[model samples]
Target: MLYIGIDLGTSAVKLLLMDETGRIHNVVSREYPLFFPHPGWSEQNPEDWFEQTLAGLEELVSGADRDKVAGISFGGQMHGLVILDENDAVIRPAILWNDGRTVKETDYLNQEIGRDRLSEYTANIAFAGFTAPKLLWVRDNEPENFARIRRIMLPKDYLCYRLSGTFATDLSDASGMLLLDVKNRRWSKEMLEICGVTEDQLPQLFESYEKVGTLKPELAKRLGLPEAVVIAAGAGDNAAAAVGTGTVGDGRCNISLGTSGTIFISSRQFRVDSNNALHSFDHADGTYHLMGCMLSAASCNKWWMDDILATKDYAGEQADITKLGENHVFFLPYLMGERSPWNDPMARATFTGITMDTTRADLTQAVLEGVCFATRDMYEIARSLGVHVDRTKICGGGAKSPLWRRMIANILNIKVDVPACEEGPGMGGAMLAMVADGVYATVEDAANAIVKVRETEEPDPELVAKYEERYRQFRTLYPALKPVFQEIAK
Candidate 1:
């Protein structure tokens, strides 16, 4: 049997076709536009997502054995607010996860309502990117649209509804919405009341590997697939990426350095930190995981190389960065504000300690090191919670760079394992589909069978020691600049 994985990303929908044995047969990607109506606000049309996904699926399965396709699943960008009217038509453009227009709503939740109550209700506090804040924003700013809302859906759930005619979401994705009692894996009643929404407005919840419904006959037929094709409940992008990298079971970790950077740690038990800095969310594997997300990572490098330096030669620029841990210049990787430990959307990127003697290599190296240093901040938080992580699997675009991988391993003082297949969330989505199809008994079984390690980068004591000192200084810069960032934003 064959399985299909759809990764509904911010810029594009990536589709993957895989066989029962985990061999990828075909892959297709379709790009869509991201709209910004106001400064710091991000939105996308749900119809664009469905249309692109439909077209991508048609292309993905074109040369494959259509009759053998058994299931389809998804991994998508989380925390986007999609609403539908009574007629099931989209009410408005989706407010995306990267959107930062919910400052007022977020402040109201974190201050007026209080973070303690929120953490009690949902096991997480309000962030500008969270769905609860977005809902509150819509209610306050667009009351007319809010009045028309019949259903609330996340980005991928919209696609799931279009494909399977089922309004459903997986635990991992719902956990990020600030509407789930994550510790218990259910919608939080208090949050529903707080957001002025009812449980009926939300989608039915399922574990990521569970089957939601069969594909709609029209969609299946259009794609030349069987009507019986199972539609598995999918996961949030990071959790899906973790599954693809085989970072399941207790003590497993996966670090993703895409546009956003995330440190994902899987656990059999549910745990939340004292400060709620790390997200306590349900895992795609029917367990639980803690994640720390940084708003910018690889984008920092992109900004420096393309926007600042006016060149697309990322490797050419990085080639001169031979001095690993001794650069005097330091950078703060907060290009799009920040999340995780800081949670400050006002924070701005800075290049500090640059001397007249600083070379281009020194500045370039700082950007990479800054990202690694921020990653270590999350690792320290996990360690403080008594979750010992000796190693982590690395994935995403930045993981392809050997220098960045080495920096991550040394700076975090952990063994960094690289996966043979780095398809990230798309691959994980297919694996979930295989589980739903009964080709694998469990998510863990599917992960263990499919994920293969290509190589490992072990931390060196000398390099680790140097990075340790550098990280100490890097951690202090954020606090020193906090008030400055706030003032500038005002």
Candidate 2:
């Protein structure tokens, strides 16, 4: 039998088809527009995502034996605010995870509501990206629209509800919403009250591999699928990517370098950082994990290459960026503000230490190293907690770049393993569906059988020494600029 994995991303919906044995048969992607009506605001029409995802699914399974498709699952961009009216209509364009419009709301939660209480309720403090803050933004600014809300959901749950006739979300995805009692894997009543939301407004929670429902009969028929096809509640993008890379069990780590960068470490235990820098969330594999997310990763390079350099040749541009750690140029990857260690929405991207002799290659290398350094910030935090990671699985858009992969390996001073099937969340989505269909006993069992390392990038001692010093310097720059960032915001 076959399974379908749909990865609902920020820019596009990527669909994948695979048999029970994990061989990918076909893949399709459909792009949609991302809108920015205000400087710090990011939004996307839910209708646009729906249309593109449906079209992509049709194209994904076009040539395959659609009748054999047993299940469908999702891995999606997390923490987007998608609200529905009583009539089940999308109330507004979704406020995205990278949207920084919730700075005020986040402050209200962190300062007024108090981070200690918020963390006690949800196992996380306030961040501009979380759903709770976005809800406050809507309530304060668009009271009429907020009053009309009947249901609240993450980006992929909207798709799940539309396609499967079920309003549900999984633990891993819900963990980022700042609405879930993540340690307990349930809705936090205190958080709900604080956000002026009720339990009825939220979707039912499921384990990531659990079956939500079967596909809607009409959707299944139109798409040449059986009505009995299962719909499994999938995970947040990072968690799904972690599962895809086999970063399961205790102490395993994975780094995702997509539009957002993340360092994910799976832990059997539940523990939040003292500084609340890392996110403590339930994992898809029936355990707990910690994640540190950066708002911009590969997108930084994309902005530099496309907007600044005016070129489509990303590979050619990186080909000349050979001097890894000797460069005086430094870049702070905060284009969409920042998350993880620094929850500063006022932070702006900057190029520091650029001299008159700094060449284009130095600038490009700085962008790559900057992202790696930011990831290392998370790694160091995890180390401070005694997690002790010596190797990590790498995935996402930046993981495709050999230069970036090498830089991450050395910068973090850990071996980076590239998965044979580096499809990330999509592959993991399908694997979760397989578990839902009883093809596997557990998520870990499925992962152990399917995920394979294609190659490993090892760190060099000299390069590690060079980056150790550079990172020490890189760390100080953020602290110095933070006061400036706050001043500029004012």
Candidate 3:
């Protein structure tokens, strides 16, 4: 049988098809516009997602044995607020995960309501990117639209509803909403009340591999799919990427360096750090995982290459960065503020310790090292929680850079394995569909059976020692600049 995984991303919807044996049959991507009406504000028409997804699906299965298709699922951008009216029409443009318009709402949640209380209720604190804060933003800024809201949906759940005619979300995605009692695997009533929304507005939650519903007959037929195809509840992008990389089971780790960077550690047991530096969320594998996210990762390199150096040849630019861990210049990767340990939306990027001796290679090396150090900050927090990670799988766009991969392995002092196929969330989404269709017994089993490692990058002790010292200095810069960042934001 064949399964389809839809990755509803910020910029586009990528669709993948796979056989029961995990061979990718076909892949298709459809782009959609991301609107920025104001600086720091991101929005998208939810209907655009559905339209493009449908169009992508048509292309994804064009020549496949349509009758053999067994299931479809999704992995999507998390924390976007998608509202629907009583008639099931979209109420307004979706407030995206990257949207920064929720500063006031986030401040209210973290300050007025208290971070301790929020962590107790939802196992998370508010950030400008989280859905709960977006909900509050809508309620306060556009009360008329809030009054018309009949259902609240995450980005992918909106697509799931359009596909299956079922309003549902998975635990992995819901965990990020700040409306979920993550530790309990349920919705938090206190958070619901605080958001001024009811439980009825929320979608029914399911496990990532659980079957939500069969695809709608007419819609399935429209896409040349069988009506009996099972639709599984998929997960948040990082969780789905973890599943794809086979980072399931206890102590497994996956580091993603995309537009954002994340250090994800999977565990059989649920655990939260006392400091709450990492996000404690349910995993796509039906257990738990802790994730530390950095807003800027590969984008830092992009900004340097595009905006600063006026070049598009990233490889050519990185080619000169031969010296591994001895650059005197240091960079702080906070281009889009930051999340995870710092949780400071006011934080700004900085290039410190630059001397006249600093070459272009030294500055480029600093940018890469900065991201690795930020990831290490999360790694240290996870270790403090007694989560031992000896190695990790690496994926995403930045993982394509061998230099960055080596930097990560040395900085974190872990063996970094690269997957044969780095499709990430889209691949994981198809794997979940396979599980829902009984192609595999469990998520772990499916991952073990299908996910293949291509190569491993080992850290040299000398390099690791150098990076350790550099990381110590890198960690201090954030605190030193915190006051400055706050002042500038004001």
lDDT of 3 by residue, 253-315 (tens): 999998889999999998987777899999999999999988889889999989999999999
lDDT computed for candidate 3: 0.92
Model 1 spans with C-alpha error above 4 angstroms = none
**What lDDT score goes with residue 193 in model 1?**
95
lDDT (Cα, tens digit) per residue for candidate 2, span 3-42:
9888999999999999877799999999999999999989
Residues 369-470, candidate 1: write the lDDT tens digits: 999999999999999999999999999889999999999999999999999989999999999999998989999999989999999999999999998888
Clashes of each: 0, 0, 0
lDDT of 3 at 171: 98
Per-model TM values vs. the true structure: 0.99, 0.99, 0.98
Give the Å error, residue 249, model 3: 1.1
lDDT of 1: 0.93
Q: Between prediction 2 and prediction 3, which has the larger lDDT?
A: 2
lDDT over C-alpha atoms for residue 312 of model 3: 91
Q: Residue 418 of model 3: what lDDT? A: 97
Pairing residues by index, what is the TM-score of model 1?
A: 0.99
Error of 3 at 396 (Å): 0.7
Q: What is the C-alpha lDDT of each candidate?
A: 0.93, 0.93, 0.92
Show pairs that collide, candidate 1.
Answer: none
